[model samples]
Target chain A: MKYLPLIWAGIWRKRSRAILMLLQIASAFVLFGVLQGLDTGVSQTIAKQHGDRLYVSSSVAMGDPLPIGLLARIQSVPGIEYVTPRADFDGSYQKLDQFVPVVAGDVDSFFKVYEELKTSPAAIRALRNDRSGAIVGILTMRKYGWRIGDHIVLTSGLPTSNGSHDWGFDIVGTYDTPDQPTSATALITNFTYLNESRLTGRDHADMFVTKIDSAADADRIGLAIDNAFANSSNETHTQSEAELAAAQLQQLGDLDFIVHGIIGAVFFAVLFATGALMMQSLRERVPELAVLKTVGFTDRRVMALILAESVTFCLVAAGIGLALSTLLLPLARQQIGFSRVPDIVFAEGAACAVVLAFVSGWIPASRGSRLQVVDALAGR
Target chain B: MSFLDQTFALTATALRSMSGRRGAALVTVIGVTTVVGVLISLLALSNGARALGGSEASPDEAVVLGSGAASSQQSVLTRDEALAVRNAPGIKRAPDGTLYLSATTMVSVDAIRSNGKRGSVALVGFTPAIRLFAPGVKLIAGRMYRPGVHELIVSDPLRKMYRGLELGDHITLRGTEWTVVGIAAGNGTVNDSILRADADTVMSAFGRNTYQQVIVELTSPAAFDTFKSWALSNPALPVQVKTEAADFDDTFGQLHRLLDFVAYFIGGVMASGAICGALNSLYASVDARRRELATLRAIGFGGGPIIASVLIEGMLLALPGAFLGAAAAWLLFNGHVLSTEGLIFTLTVTPGLLVVSVSWALAMGLIGASLPALRAARVPVAVALRAT
Candidate 1:
């Protein structure tokens, strides 16, 4: 710790070169921080699975709706706690670019099945009483700046019975899940109103969400539910909520592969640049290091000083880079209209910075430590 | 020394000095290589995706979609509306003397991928005239599906991605079993992502009473505007007409834009880091060569030759880095196939992409060399000599 001043002086000796290297390291970590944040956001969205819940949909295709009558049959299955049916309506708000996913279902049953949605009893009653009442997720509410009792209209891409594609709903409440920020982007409405008002495709539910009494019964119940509809017109496929979310996220893109590819490229270049600079700086200071060794500084202390200098360069640059990304993440999320991006993963990033510091500093520091005082003094 | 003699001497001196500082030169080369390699690979991905979207339609074809429809899947046209479009002028006739028009229906069906993930696949239903419209399409295995039968033809790429898509395999759609009779391959078009069946049969199976869109072969490319105006003039029918190429642009424009933005944004960010690294290495080299450069100046060498030598050295180092990076990208990503949302594309490492990558590296090298070269030129001879 007492060698801090010595290491600090070593770094600042070449101000321009040190500053440029600092900028290089900072930029690399900035990319790392932002990409890691996005990667975590996507992974977390798929990873937020309630173990006891399962999603049941048509085996034919995602767009195929199961009969509404199947709700009672699914409810009768043993080990089922609650079941709800949801119908998806893909639409945009006022413009083509503002695509908002809307899901309609029985409000009471939906609340029962998805207990993670935190809503008051008054909001639930309003949704049940008003046929056109809808509940908007917190993110959507904040994004559109909507308040209670606001009537929002969506233009359905699909035609409706009234010969127009306009669907209006009253926003009666806001919903949020404690851990899953992605869920807060969905808009939920009353299925009865959608089924009655829509010009076509009535008496059908897009999928069924069933909460089982025990996690152990998930596989058995999934198979049993599929068996009940086997040989029937509407055969079903049931998957645990985790599996369903994972599959859906996978369809978006192989984000993990792309993120890791970019991160690998950035770090590989950073390591080479930083390591080369460290070696060059150490080579220039060999005579100084020899003088220190001759003046009662041990070889290990010389090595420690060099290592500390390099690690200080890396960690300080990483700190600034991570701080910059943290400040910019919210703006990025706002521009992208995705609320799921969390703050930078500090633990993973800090650990990475530390490892990079060691790797970049190791060879140069060892060489400094192995320097012979007589030879280095004689300018060999 | 004469100008030629000075130029040769400076060039020889720069080469000798670079050889002495091989470590720093190597670092600069590797840094540039990383930036160019990453940039080229990402741009290749964007290019591949754009090609898939753009190659689906030709200029000689036109399509009539329901009013205000953004995509075929969202468009709905009743039989009467489609019949009205069929009667529109400027439509070419096939050898059978029938108008070469195909009413198509697009639907998304749930399917299990080979990796056991459940995802949606696009099922496109088109009239038999589709073979005429897309002449480049070919049946690679088995025969085409017969109309009115519960038969389907899967694209080769789709078959590779999904299960139960092999020849003779049965896929259940809307509770009806359909046999996969053939594997079709399109010429890098969006058709490669779809399953094909008879339009009428698909409508009845899915209980859809409307066609999504009508595609017509125009008599000539110039006839597209005439056909479009004719289709839109029928006030009784609510329809919009566009060239087939325009429809593809509408459908996939946003996706292409996003991919391009991502490619450029990431490439720019990475290139900045590489440039900074290059600048640092070059600055250090100039500092190390202060005395030598000052001595050269005192011996009557012009500043132009000194600056030219540094710039030339920078380009010489950067060009090979660019080549190495481009070669690496080609080795790693050429013909690499990836799928997203059921659309599959292969990364293409074209000569055009290689040129773009090399240009990016050269730009970095030039910018990195400028400031250091200026500082080296401006170093007063007496001050540089008197120091150290």
Candidate 2:
């Protein structure tokens, strides 16, 4: 209790040093928070996908289209409850850089598949009645300044497009999902309209979505379905929601390693800078530390106090950094668009920053503690 | 002794004394190493991509894109178009006047996991004559297919990523059974992730009648002028011809530039914070050694040597840090190959990256040490000595 003044005086004596260290820690915390939030949000979005839902793609590859005739065969698969077959018409939004996922699904089946969608019955009816009507995510609606019943056209960079951008659809209803904010990056239209108008030939559905009674039977059901088509014209590969999400992420290549390397490099640089600052600060205070020792303070006690001071400084800085991070995320999301940034949450990662901040301080604190009082007094 | 000489001696003495402070020296090294290492890794990523994309093509070669195909994936030509291209004027031909032309298709395939993991693999179907268009591609094992056989060649990277795919291993692709009869290497192009096969086999399997792109070789640089004018004169001919190097650059340039921008943008922002930390520490070091500097000044040491000494010490500390950082980055990312969208590329670490990293560290040290050196040099003798 008596050492409160000493701790306060220590900070006051090197206010600039303390402030600089705090700022350093705060910036690191902010970065960690935002990055972690993004990763977490992307995962959570995928994980939150309706557990009952399943996606069936070509056993051969994702890019290959499944025969439209296979939709009924998939629907006839044993233990299958409901099925929604979607045809992927790959296109871009108004901007060339932005990839807009255009999916053609049965209206009733899609509504049934996404049980969490909370929309007026009239809107759902409106979507179902018009063949060319489209349904986009809530975030997507905000992004493109589109309203219900607005007409939107999408262009394909692929050679299949006619003069200008090939296809257009009317906006019917805006939807939201806790699964992934970026799911709004896609626009869902009627499969019937797509098949009748733009699409040609036997290749109809890109993939089929199936829902079952229990997730425990997911593997068993997936195997049975794949086995059903093993020797047939169009082979199938059925994956769980998680596996599909993982496969999509895998397209980005070794994300776990890449993200880790990036974060590790960034943090390593931050730690180095902090350690140097702390060492220099401690060296300057050697005489002061000696004076404290002479005044009957034990080395261990002095070390603990310094460590505690550092931990406190780091924690405070991290808190400010986290606060700043939360503020920055919405703006970043807005600027980068929902497809890239999504709804990123930073709470859990800020906790990690707090721990890192203390660890960074401890290295220098331990060195400061090991100083010989006599040498320190003699200005060595 | 002259005042300047004395100052230089004092400055050297001070540096030697400071060098003995192992703890402080270690801290400086640690700081500098991290800054340098990170900067180098980013440089490697950018330059490695550039080298891969840039050094892969030949100068005399030309890439012919079909009228509708803006990208390699979109470009497809009929047999007549390919033959027309081959017979075009000034096309570099063998002594028999046979042109160096290869028609190829580029398609992306999903690699099925024998172990339940999925990966992307690029599928390139080319004629046996593809060797002429891509001279850098080399077969490591087995032999090229006998023209019409269902034999396929796998890239070295493809062999590593997938299972049961070796020389003579059979794999079904696009409902057609293909025997992996050979292994090939691209000249650091995206083809490293591809499954190379006969062009006819690939086209028939994928249900495409036309070729994706055609590569043609011209005899001389000046021939391109006549070729272009003649080609433009026939407006109905839906083929755009450009140097093979230019087409490859255009194909991957946007992506490479995007990655470079990201690496630099993120790195630059992070470096600013690190620099701030360096400056603060140096300022503290100079302030603490006030009496030490003042005493040297009182003994007839001048300011210039003092500044130089402090700067040198900071740089010395930084150089070790830079090396440490570079070594660590190399240990982590060097030769590491991973796939994205099915294209495999090794995280190329080169000697040039290390030099860049160390140079960056040295620069940071010089900048960081300047103000502190100035403070140490300008310290008032009486005031510094009078403190405690």
Candidate 3:
């Protein structure tokens, strides 16, 4: 504790050199914090507690169109709480580049199954009363500047019985999810309207989702639902909600490996730079270290001071980098689907900083300690 | 000596001194390597996507899709509507009165990946006219699938990415078994990601009542405008017409743009760190040679020569890392097959990507050298000489 000022002064002996190394180490941590934060957030999204929720899609492929009749059969299965048929009705707004993701289902059962989606009962009733009424999400509303009671026309690839590709709806209400804001981008409508009005793909749904009262029975109940139509032409692939999300995220091409690859290369390079700079700075301090030795500073004590200097420098740099990352994280919220940097990433950054400091500073510190006072004083 | 001569002599002298400062020089080299390697790896990915999107796109070919459809998956065209497109004017006609057109439909099928995870791949069915529309597609193994039978010919990449896709294997979808008859290689287009089969058979088996889109080869590139007006003339055919290139753009341009954005953003952050590292090393090196440079200045050498020499040394040190980094990325990732968003593609490290790597590395080297170069030119000769 008494040598604190001495170590601090050693780190800043040459202001320009120290500052350059500081910037170098800090920039590496910036990449580390951002990448690891985003990576951890993605894993958290996959690791969200969806144990009680179960998804049933076609065994052949997702979006393979299961019959609506299967929805009732699955609902009748034992231990099921609520079930809703989900169908995607993505459309293009005024411009072809603008895509509006609309989900069609029995709004009453759908909202009950997906309790995270917040909306008023009036909107549900309106969607039921008017087949063309749609409940748009708040994010979608803000994006297109839409107001309730506004009539909007969206063009879809699916054709109506009249051979028209246009689907018009009256915006009845707005909805949002606080926990996961990205889910708030969906536009919800009643399933009956889309199924009955579509020209060819009628009486079918993309998938079915059901919730169980207790998470303990989730796997057994999911299997029972799949068993109901195991050998039928429309076989189902049942999975827990979390498993489904993980599979979807995996479809983005082994994200963990990519993130780790880039991070690994960055660290490898940073490690070499830190080591070289430590050695260079230590070489310049031989005479001062010899003077300390002549004044009866133990060899071990000299080594500790060198190590302390590195620890202080690297940790301070990492702290600055992580602080900046937390501030800039929100800008990437939409892309990475994470609003905040996870706490574990900050902890991991600090651990990395310590390890880097120790490894890079070890040889230089030992060399400084092992120097002969007489030889070092002679400028050897 | 002239200014240029002085610059050359000083640079040579600095190069001679670089051996003593090998550690600092090594740090700069390694810093540049990481920045360039990562940048090129990502650029290579985006470049591969761009290559796939634009490769083999003929200006004379036109794609017709339902007006509201964003991609082929969302498009739907009834049989009569598709026939109307092929019957329109400006379509190339053979001597036997056949039109150069192919109506296609797609169905997503579940498959197990090599890693034993559930994945999906596209099975697309094209009419007999497909041979004319895509003349470059060829069977790499086995034979072409026979029409009116449940047979599929998988693309090379598709077969490599998923299991149970080998030739002679049977795949069951919806209680129907389809035999894999051949392995095909495409001309770096969307078809490379999909398996091909008979259009009518796929539609009937998948319970699809409509063709997703119709692709036609025009008599000339100029014929696209004529075909567009003709297809939109009747309200019965509510379809959109675009040159094949534009259609490819609509299908994949956004994804490529996204890849490029990610590459540049990550590369920029890493380059900033690499610049800091190079700067620190150059500073150390300049300090090491402070006495030597001061004595030269005291004698007669101008600051201009010293500055120019330092900058050259920095770039020269960085030059090898640019090649090594690009070479490393190429060796590790080039021609690697991967999939994202249900679209399979190969990572191709092109010559153009090498150019990107060198430019970024050299830029980092130059920016890192600037401040150090300036400080070296301004060293106080009298003070430095009298010290120590």
**lDDT scores in order:** 0.82, 0.69, 0.87
Top of the candidates by lDDT: 3
Clashes of 1: 2
Q: What pairs collide in candidate 2?
A: A45-A179, A59-A236, A59-A237, B33-B321, B33-B322, B120-B342
Considering only N, C-alpha and C atoms within 3 Å, which residue pairs clash in candidate 3? Answer: none
Question: Against the true two-chain complex, what DockQ does each candidate achieve?
Answer: 0.53, 0.32, 0.77
Per-prediction interface RMSD in Å: 2.0, 3.7, 1.2
Report the poorest 10 consecutive residues by lDDT, candidate 3 chain B.
Answer: B128-137
Output the better candidate (2/3) by TM-score: 3
Of the two candidates 1 and 3, the one with more favorable lDDT, higher being better, is 3
Instruction: Report the C-alpha lDDT of model 2 over A1-380, residue by residue, as the tens digit.
Output: 77677666776667766776667667666666566655665576567555667788876677566777887877887788888888775566766445566778888877777676655577678888988888887777887788987898776533331222256788888777664454456787888877766413234677888888888888888888888888765788898887787788767665566555666766776666665666666767888887877887787887888866665566677777667667666655633333333334444554555566567667667776777878888877
**Residue B111 lDDT, candidate 2, scale 0-100:** 69
lDDT ranking, high to low: 3, 1, 2
Which 10-residue window of candidate 2 chain A scores lowest in summed lDDT?
A157-166
TM-scores of all candidate predictions against the true structure: 0.93, 0.84, 0.97
Model 1 C-alpha lDDT per residue in residues A1-380, reported as the tens digit of each score? 77788889999988988888888888888788788888887677566578789888888776577889999899899999888889886667877557778888788789888889988898999999999998888988988888999999887655566556678889999899776555577788998988888756778888999889988889999999999999888888898987877777778767788889988988998999988889988889999999999998898988888888888888899888777777656656643334433644777777788888889999999999999999999999
Please tell me what DockQ candidate 2 reaches.
0.32
Pairs that collide, model 1: A61-B110, A161-A199
Which of candidates 2 and 3 reaches a greater lDDT?
A: 3
Per TM-score, the best of the predicted structures is 3
For B1-388, candidate 2 gives per-residue lDDT tens digits of 7656765676567666765455545555665666566656666665556655556567777777765334555455666666677657877766764567778876666766445577767677776566656455688888776557777788876787788678989877656777888888644557676788788877777665667677767777778777766665775465767787778776777656866775665555455556556667677667767888898789777788888877876777678777888897788777666566666666777887777777777877887788788988999999889989
lDDT of 3 at A265: 91
